[model samples]
Target: MLWWGKEMNEWQVLHASDLDFLLENSSSPYDYSGDNNESEYCCGTPPCSQDFTFDRTFLPVLYSLLFILGLLGNGAVAAVLLSQKAALSSTDTFLLHLAVADMLLVLTLPLWAVDAAVQWVFGSGLCKVAGALFNINFYAGALLLACISFDRYLSIVHATQLYRRRPQARVTLTCVTVWGLCLLFALPDFIFLAANHDERLSATHCQYSIQQVGHTARALQLVAGFLLPLLVMAYCYARILAVLLLSRGQRRLRAIRVVVVVVVAFTICWTPYHLVVLVDTLMNMGALARNCSQENHVDVAKSITSGLGYMHCCLNPLLYAFVGVKFRERMWQLLIRLGCPEQREHVRQLSRRDSSWSETTEASYSGL
Candidate 1:
C-alpha cells in the first residue's frame, strides 16, 4: 500500500500502450492525455502527481459541513434512543450503538481535513489513536448493522416465547460482544498507524504501512475490513428477508420495512467505498494487471476512490433522516420542546396518555 505511488511508474513500462489505447477509446469529452507520457514508466502526470492540485478546493469546506451535520444527526439519534422510557429492546440497543459508532467516526473528519490541507501535523501517538478509533467505529457500525438484521429476523420469522423471555439480557450481551470484537479488530490499526514524511511531496502523512508483515497484513485488513463484514451483513439480511416473507402480522411487516430500509441504505452508502478500497488494495498488492505508461492514471483513480469513501461520512445522516421515522419524530419533538415550552408540555401529555393506553391494552391481553 505504501509503495503504490512508486509501483505505478514501474508498471507503466509494461502497459503504456494499452493505457493510451484505453484513453483514446474512452467516451469522455475531455482529452485523456495532454503533454504526458502514456507509459507506466512515467512517474508523474496531470491527475496522478502527488502535487496535482485538486480543483475541488471546496473539499475541506464540504467535509466540515458533513462533520457538523453527521455529529448533530447521529448525536440526536443516540439521545432519542437513550432517553426513551420503554425497555431497551434489541433493535433500539443496536441502533444506539450504531449511532455512537458513526458519531465517533464523524468526529474525526476535521482532523482529516486539516491533514489534507496542511499535511499531518499531529504527532505519531495521536495518529495511531485516531486511526484506531476510526477503525473501531467502522467495524462496530458494520457489526451492529448485521446484528440488527439478525435481531429483526428473530423477532419476525423465529418469534417465540423464549426469544422474548429475557430480551434485555440478550440485548446487553450482544452489545458487549460487538464492542469486544470491534476492539480486537482495531488493535492492529492502533499499532500500525504513525507519522511519516513523504519526501517527494514534502508532506507529513498519518498512515498505516505494514512493511514488516508485508502482503499478509494487507490481506488480513482487506478481509476483516471489507470482505468478511460484507458477507456477514449480506447473509443476515438475506435470512431476515426470508423470515419476513414467511411471517404474517402487521407489526412484522412494519418491522421488515424498517429493516429493509436500513439494510438498503447501508448497502447503498458503503458498497462503492468498499469496492474501491478492495480494488485499490489489490492493485497495491500487485494483484491487478495494469498496462499504462504514466503512473498518474492509477494515482488519479486512487484519489477519486478515496473521495468516494469520504462521501460515506455524509450519507449516514441522510439514512437516519429518511429511514428512521421515530428518530425524525423525536428530532421534531426536540425542536418543538426548544421552541415552545407550552406546546412541548402538551405533546408530552399526549405521549404519556398513548403509553398508558398501550400498557393497559397489554395488561388486558395478559389477563385474558
Candidate 2:
C-alpha cells in the first residue's frame, strides 16, 4: 500500500497535463506538476520525466511471485494452525493472526500487480477497498509481530505465564485491539484513494487523490507500523538474548540462533523501506531540500525497498512457524491424522528425537 506525503496537497491543484507520472506505479509521494513527455516546474524547479518501463515490466513479476509464494506458505500455516485449535499456545495464536494478515495482504497483490503492468481496471470503489485492505493488514501484521516478541520476552526472560489463565480471552482481546487500531489507520486510504485519469500518462491510477499535507497519516504509519514495533522487537529480543546467554543447554543455544535470525531477517527486509519513507517524510516536511533528482531517486528507492518489505510476508512462515520444532511436529501429526501414513513414522521419529529439546524450547518461547 502506497502512502501519501506532503506533496499531495500541491498535486490536487495541478492541471491534467501537468500532473505527476502514473501515481499507481509509485509507493512514495507522487511527484506533482510533471508530465511524462516533458519537464514541468514544481517546487521552483523542473521535474524529471520518469520512465516507468522498468516498473511496468518488473513490478508485476515481483508482485506475482510474492503472491504465489506468500499464499502457499501462509496458507499452509493457517491450515495447520486451525487443525490444532484445541492445543494452541499464545504464540500459536499470534502466528495464526499473522498468517491471516499476510494472506490478506497478498490477496491485494493481484490488483496491484495488474495496476503496475497495466492500469487500474478496477473502478474507484474497488481501488479504495484494495488500498484500505492493504493498509489494514500491513499495520496489523507488524503489530502482531511486536505482540509475539513481547510474549516471547515474557516467556523466556521473565518466565511468567501472564496469559495462562483465560488465555483465549486475553489473546482474543489483544488481536481484536490490533485490528481495531489498523482499521483506524486505514481510514485515510478509504477516504482519499480513488481511480483518477492522469492526462499526461493517459492512464487511470488508483492513488491518493486529495490536497492535504497528510503528514499525520504518514507519521502514524511510520510510528505505529514501523518504529514502535521495531523498538518493541529490539528490546524484547535483546532481553531474551541476555537471559538465554546465562543458560547452558543445546536448546538455549538453538533458541538464541533462531532469535538472532528472526531479528536479522526482519531488519533486513523492513529497515530499508522505512528508511526511505523516513527520508521522504523529511523531504515532505521541508526538513530537507527537495530536487527533481532526489525525488526521482526516492521514488525509485521506495519501489525497490517496498518490494523487499513485501517479501517479509513470505518469510514470516519460515522464520516464525517452520523454524519451531513443536510447530513442525504438530504439522506432521496433523498430516498423519489426514491419512498420510508416510508421515506417521516420520512424526514418530521426530517426536522421539526432539522430545527433550522441544519441551524446553516450548517452555522458553511457547511454540514460537
Candidate 3:
C-alpha cells in the first residue's frame, strides 16, 4: 500500500521550459515524487528521497536519564497530592492532572528510544498504543495548561458568586472533559500508526503512512493538536496579564508571576515543536516543491526542533517544583515525616496554608 500515491516522475526529464515554469510558479515543486529512473530524482540531485538516519549512540543514554528523572519528579508531585487530606481546590486538581499527563507522556519515551536505536521490534499493536498515548498526553497537557490560565483569570479578574458554588466540582468536571476530548483527538493515531520496513535502511519504522486516511489524520493534528489549543492559551494568558495589571496587591502579583512563568515555559517548550510539525506537514503537501534541494537543511532544522520538544519533558517537572509553593512544602513534609515526629506540626501548618491561601486571596481579589 503506497502512501501519497506511487512516487512521482523524476524532475530531470522535464524540458527546460517546463522546469522554468514550475520553478517560477510553484513554491515547492521539488516536494513531488519523480520517477525513480530519472537522473533528477536520483539521490544526489534535487527531489531526492530523504535519508532518515537514526543515530543510536546516544539514544539509550538519553532515554534512561529522561525516564528516571521524569518518573521520579512527577511521581513525587503525585505522591504529595495524594497524601493531602484537603478537598482538592481547582488549582490542586489542575496540577494533579498536569502531573499525570507529564508522567504518562514520559512513560512512552523508552519505547520511542528503543525504536530509534533499533528496528521497531515492538509490533503494530504496541506502536499504535504508544503513538496514541503520546498524542493524548501531549494534547491533554496543553489543554490543562490553558485551563489553568483561565482558572487563574476567573479567580483573579472576574470574581463572581458563581465561583463559590461548587468550584471544586466544576474544576473536576472540566479536567475530565479535557481528557475525554484529548482521547477523541488521539483516536486517529490508534487507527493509523503502523510499522513499516524501509529496505534502504534495513529497519522497521513506526510511522504514520500516507495511505488511507493519513491526510485526514494530519489535518486533525494540525487543528486539534496545535491551532485550537494555542489560540485558547494565548487568549487566556493575554486576559490574565491585563487583569494582573489592573489589580495591584502583593499576593496577586506573586500569583500572576507564577502563572506567567508557567505560560512562558509552556510556550518556550512547545512552540518550536509545533512549528517543526507545521513545516513538515507543509513540505509533505508540496508547499515547498520548488525548494527540494533545501530538504537537507529542513531535516537538520527538524532535528533541533524535536530535541527542544524532548527537553520539555524534563523541564515540566522542574517548572512545578519552582512554581507551586504547596508542592515544595508537601515534598519537604514528606521527607521530614519520614525522619522525625517533631516536624508534624510544621507539616500541618503548611497544609493549612496551602488549603486556605486561595480562599483568603479570593476575598482580596473579590474587591472586599
Clash count list over all predictions: 12, 0, 13
lDDT, residue 298, candidate 2:
82
Residue 271 lDDT in candidate 1: 63
- 97-164: candidate 1 lDDT, tens digit per residue: 88888888878777776676676788888877877787788778777877766655454445542237
Query: By lDDT, who's the top model here?
Result: 2
lDDT by residue for model 2 over 82-119, one digit each (tens)? Answer: 88757788877887898999999999988988887788
- The runs of at least 3 residues in candidate 1 whose Cα sits more than 4 Å from the true structure, single-residue gaps closed, are 1-49, 55-59, 160-166, 212-218, 246-251, 291-298, 304-307, 336-368
TM-score of every candidate: 0.73, 0.86, 0.78
**Candidate 1 global TM-score:** 0.73
Candidate 2 lDDT: 0.76
Error of 2 at 198 (Å): 1.8
Colliding pairs, model 2? none
- TM-score of candidate 3 relative to the true fold: 0.78
Give the clash total for candidate 1.
Answer: 12
Off by over 4 Å in 3: 1-54, 161-163, 211-216, 290-293, 340-368
Instruction: Give one digit per residue, the lDDT tens place, for model 3 in 302-342.
Output: 55555566566667667656875655666777778678678
